[model samples]
Target chain A: MTFEKWMRESLDRVETALEHFLPGTDIAPAKLHDAMRYAALGGGKRVRPLLCHAAGELTGASAHAVETASAALEMIHVYSLVHDDMPAMDDDALRRGKPTVHVQYDEATALLVGDALQSQAFIALTTAGNGLNDAQQAALVRELALASGSIGMAGGQAIDLESVGRKLSRPELETMHRKKTGALLRASVRMGALAGATPDAAALKALDDYSAAVGLAFQVVDDILDVIADSATLGKTAGKDAKDDKPTYVSIIGLDASRELAAQLSRDAHAALEPFGARAQRLAELADLVVNRVH
Target chain B: MTFEKWMRESLDRVETALEHFLPGTDIAPAKLHDAMRYAALGGGKRVRPLLCHAAGELTGASAHAVETASAALEMIHVYSLVHDDMPAMDDDALRRGKPTVHVQYDEATALLVGDALQSQAFIALTTAGNGLNDAQQAALVRELALASGSIGMAGGQAIDLESVGRKLSRPELETMHRKKTGALLRASVRMGALAGATPDAAALKALDDYSAAVGLAFQVVDDILDVIADSATLGKTAGKDAKDDKPTYVSIIGLDASRELAAQLSRDAHAALEPFGARAQRLAELADLVVNRVH
Candidate 1:
C-alpha cells in the first residue's frame, strides 16, 4: 500500500480501537470520562500509534494486536500531553488546536483525567482476547511501565523543569529529550515488535537503532518547528520553549544545524531498517514522516 | 504467630521490598526520585500491604511474590494519597504526619511523583523473576490497572470532587468510596490470592466478599476518625471531609450509626472468611485491626 493510504487506514483503526476501549461519556463520573475521551480522541497526528503500527508491520503482528497496542501508546502519549499542559507543568492552553484538558475542564478534573488515562492505557494492554499471549502482554506492560516511570518520561520532565533558564550543553539537552519524548517513542516500536512473534536478536537491535534515530529526529524536528512554525500550524503555543527559556536543539546548535541534524538522524533511521528491506517499508516511511511533518 | 508479630514482620518485608523496587534518591533527577522515596518509603499504616500479605497466606503464595505485590499495592495507595493531597485536588498540606508531596516538593513535582510511583507500582508487578508466571503477571497487571483507572480509584475521586458540597445518599456514598479507596483495597486482597495458586471459585468469592466488607469498613472508620480524631492523632487533616462539606458515613448516617455499621461490616468480613476456617486467621485479625485502629 502507498504510505498515505497505509497511514490513513492505521489511523482509522487506532481511533476505532481507542473509542472502543475508552469509557463512554454517558458513564458514571461522566465528566471525567468525557475529559478523557476529549483529550485522547480527535487529537494530534497519532505519530506514536503510526510508529507502533509501522513497526508491527515489520513482524507481521496481528492487526488486532497492533490496533490495541496503538491505542495504548496513543493513550500514554495523550496522558503525558495532558499532564504536561496542566497549569502546574507547562501551563499551556492549546493542544492539537484545541483547549487543553485543564483549560477545557477544571484542573482537578484534568489531573484525574491524566491519571485515569494512564491506567486505561495499561488496561488496553492487559485486556484479554487482544490476540497477544500472556508473555507478550506481561512484557508489553513492563516495557510501557518502565518508559512511563521516573527513570524515563517523568524523570525527563523533572530534568526539563530544572533545566529551565539554564544553558544546557548539547548532551544535556539530548539526554532530557531522549528520556522525555524519546523513551515512549522507542517503546512504541519495541512494543509493536513484541506484540507479534519474537524477532531475532539482530532484527531486534536493528529496530532499536531505527527507533532511537527516529525518536531523536522526531524531537529535533519538533525543536525546528517550535522555532519556525506558527502556533496555528503547530496546534500548540509555538515559541513557548524559548519563552520558558528551556534548552532545545535549536537553542544549542542553531536552527540550521538542528535541521541538518534532523536530516542526518532521519537518514540514520532509514539506514538502520535496511536489514529488513521491504518488510520495513512502513517503518522507513514513518521515519520520513516524523522528520518531515510540519507539526 | 500473634497478629502483632505477623504484622510487624510483614511491614518490614514490605518496606524492604519497596526500597528495593523504588529508584535510589542519588540517581539523576535526584529530586524526583528522592521525593518518590520520601512519599513511599517511611510512614503510613501500610494497611493495603497488610491486607495483601494476609490474603496471600491463604493460598501459600511465595514470600517473594507477596512482598513484591504488597509493595505494588502500597505504591498505588501512596500515589493516590499524593495526588489526593495536591492543591488542585483536596489542597491538603499534610499526609502521614508530614508535609504532603506538593508541599515538600512543588505541585508539578508532586504530580510527577504520584504519576511515577504509579508506573513504578506496575513495574514491581511485571518485573521478571518475581515468582509469578506470565499469565499471573498479566492478570495482576490488569487487576491493578482496573483498580487504578477511571472506573476505579480515579473514578471514585472524580465523584468525590463533584459531590463535595452535595449530600449523597448512603448507596451513592458507598459507590464513591468503593471506587475511590475500596477498589485498590479490594484489589490488594485479590492480587495476593492471584499471586499464589488459583483459589477455587467459592474461595475466590469468599475472599471477594471479605474484601468488600473490609474495604467499606476501612472507609467508614476513616470517616469516623476524621470526625472524632485530631490532626496529630490521625496523621492528616482530620475533619476535612466535614470542613469541605463532602458527605460521609458520619454526616449522612450519624457517627453512632456509622460506628455500628463498621462493627457490623467487620463482623461480615470475618463471616466471609468462615469458609476458609482457621486458614483466614490473619485476614480476620486484619479486619479487626482496620475497624479498631485509631489512625
Candidate 2:
C-alpha cells in the first residue's frame, strides 16, 4: 500500500480505539467527558501513533497490540497539547484548526480533561498488548510511566516554563527536548517491539537511536514550520513560540542551521535503521515525512 | 502493640517512603520538585496509608509492598488536593495549616506540580509492590488508574464542580462521593490486600464492603467537621463547602441525620470485618477513628 493509504488506515484505527477508550459525552460529568473527547477524538496527524506502528513492524508485533499502544501514546500526546494550550501555558486559542479545549470549554474542564486523559492512557496500556506475556505487559506500563513522569515529559515541561525568554545553551536545550519528547518517542518503539518479541540489548539500543533522531527531527521541523508557515497551514498560531519569547531551534540557531540540523537528524535516523534493511522502509519514510514537511 | 501505636508507626514509615520517592528540591526544575515534596512529604493524618497497612495485614503481605503501595496512594491523594486547591477549582489558600501549592508558588507551578505528582504516583506503583508477581503488579496499576481517572476521582470532582449551587438528591450525592472519595479509599484496602496476598472472592467482597462503609463514614465526618470545626483544627478552610453552595450530608439530610448515618456506616464497617477476627482489629479501629472524629 502507498504510505498515504497506510497512514489513513492507521489513523482511523487509532481514532476508533481512542473513542472506545474515552468516556462518553453523556456520562455524569458530561462537561468533563465532552472535553476529554474534544481534546482526543477529532484531529491531528497521528504522528506518534504512526511511529509506534512503524516500529511495531520490526518485531512483527500483533496488530491489536500496536493499535492499542498507539492509541495510548496519542492520548498522552493530546493530553499534553490540551494542558500546554491552557491560559497559564501557551494560551493558544486553536489546535488542529479548531478551538482549544480550554477555550471551547472552561479552564477547569480543560484541566480535568488533561488529567483524566492521562489516567485513561495508562488504562489503555493495560487493556491490550496482544502477544505480550504478563512480564512484558508490566514492562510496557513501566516504560510509559517513566516517559511521562517527572523526569520525563512533565519535568521537561517544567524546564520549558522556567527557561522562557532565557538563553539556553544548545546542550541544555537538547537535554530538555530529549526528556520532554525523546523519552515518549523512544518508548513507543520499545512498546511496539516488546508487544511481539523482545529484542536484544544491541537491537534495542539501535531502535532507541532511531527513535531519538526522528523525535528530534520532528521538533526541529516543527520549529521551522512555526516560522515559515502561516497559522492556517500550521493549524496553530504561527510564530507563537517566538512571540511568547520561548527559545526555539530557529531562534537559538539560525533558520539555515536549524534546517541543516533536521536533515542531519533524518540521516542519523536512517543510519540507525540500516540494519533492518527492508523491514525499516516505513520508518525511513516517516523520518522523511517529518523532516521534508518544509519542502 | 496497640492500634494507635501501630498507626503512628505506620504513618512514620509512610512519611519516610514518601520522602524517598519524591524528587528533591535540588533537582533541576527545583520549584516544581519542591512543590511536589511539600504537598506530599508532610501533614495530614495518613489515613489512606493506614488503611493500606491494616488490610495488608490480612494476607500478611510484605511490609515493602504495602509501604510502596501506601506511598503511591498518598501521592495520588495529595495531587488531587493540589489541583483541587487551584483558583479554577476550590480557590483555597491554605491546606494543612500552610499555604496551598498555588498560594505558595503560583498557579502554573501548582498545575505542573499536580500533574507531575500524579505521574510520579504511577511510577511509584511500578517501582515496588515487591511481593506481587508481574501479573499482579499490572493489576495494581490498573486498579489505581481506574480509581484516579475519569469516572473515578477526577470524575467525582467534576460532578462536585458542576453541582455547586445545584441541589442534588441523596442518592445522587452518594454516587458522587462513591467515586470521589470512596473509590481511592476502597482501592487503598484492595491494594494493601493485593500486595501481601490475594484473597478469595468472598473475602475480597467483604473487604470491599468494609472499605466502602469506612470511606463513606470518613466523608460524612469531614462534612460535619467542615461545619463544626475551626480552620486551625481542620488544617484547612472550614465550612467552605457550604459557603460555596456545595451540597453535603449535613446540608441535605440535616446535621442530626448526618451523624446517625455516620454511626450506621461505622457499624456496617465493623460487621464486614467479623470474619477476619483479630486480623481485622486495626481496620475496625480505623473505622472508629473516622466516624468518632465527628463526635
| Candidate 2 backbone collisions, by pair | B61-B196
Top lDDT: which candidate number?
A: 1
lDDT of 2 by residue, B1-295 (tens): 9877898899999999899778888876777788888888879888899999999998898988888889889998998999899988898999988999988988888888888888887787776445567876777788888899898999999888888999999999999999899999999999998887689999999999999999999988999999999898888998898899999999999999999999999999999999999999889999999998733
Per-model TM-score on C-alpha atoms: 0.99, 0.97
Candidate 1 lDDT by residue in tens digits, B1-295: 8888998899999999999999997787899999999999989999999989998999999999999889999999899999999989999998999999999989999999999999999899999898788998999899999999999999999999999898799999999999999999989999999989888899989998999999999999999999999999999998898889989998999999999999999999999999999989999999999999999
Taken over the whole model, the C-alpha lDDT of each candidate is: 0.92, 0.86
Model 2 stretches with alpha carbons more than 4 Å out: A128-132, B128-131
Model 1 CA deviation exceeding 4 Å by range:
none
What does DockQ come to for candidate 1? 0.91
Report the Cα lDDT for residue A239, model 1. Answer: 96
